[model samples]
Target: MTRMKELRKKKGFSQVRMQMLTGIDQSDYSKIETGKRNMSFEQCRRIALALETSMDYLAGLTDQDTPYPRTK
Candidate 1:
């Protein structure tokens, strides 16, 4: 499974719930998750926030699941 899908499932969030959280349409989110579409930087940021994970982890840049510290 893609890291995004894995994290979303780990958080017990459905695609509908993801839409509610990230303002991304469920169908579009599904496409993003299934690799049928690409997410923009803003979308990635919103999704990372909603999933409580870091973009690095989502992008496979890091194996750590923890989010990085946020700056003010």
Candidate 2:
């Protein structure tokens, strides 16, 4: 599975549920998890917030899932 799918499953969120949390359509979110589609910066930010993880982690830049402390 891709990193996105792995993390989503780890969070116990289905594509439908992830859609609800991130405002991304289920099909679109599915594509993202499957690596068939790319996410925009805003989408990435929303997904990171929904998953409580770093954008870098979601982008496969790092293995660590812990997010940085919020600045605001």
Candidate 3:
């Protein structure tokens, strides 16, 4: 699975559900998850927020799922 699918599944959200939350159409969401489509910055931010994850994670820049890590 691609990063998009992984993130969405980690949040237990279906493609339709995620699309609804992010205001993206279901078809578009499917394409994104399958890597057939690219997401805009705004869309990426909305998806990250909707999934309670960080943009960095979605973009494969980080392995941490959360937006912020707990201080040790």
User: Which candidate achieves the best TM-score against the true structure?
Assistant: 1
Ranking of models by TM-score: 1, 2, 3
TM-score, structure 3 vs. true? 0.84
With a 3 Å backbone cut-off (N, CA, C), the pairs that clash in candidate 3 are none
Candidate 1 residues lying further than 4 Å off, grouped into runs, are none
**Any residue pairs clashing in model 2, and if so which?**
none
Worst 10 residues of 2 by lDDT: 1-10
CA lDDT, every model vs. true structure: 0.93, 0.89, 0.83
What would the per-residue lDDT of candidate 3 be over residues 1-72, giving only the tens digit for each residue?
Answer: 277787777778898898789999999988888888989999998988887778889888998888865367
Which segments of candidate 2 are over 4 A away from where they belong? none
C-alpha positional error of residue 59 in candidate 3 after TM-score superposition, expressed in Å: 0.7
lDDT of 1: 0.93
Candidate 2 displacement at residue 11 in angstroms: 1.3
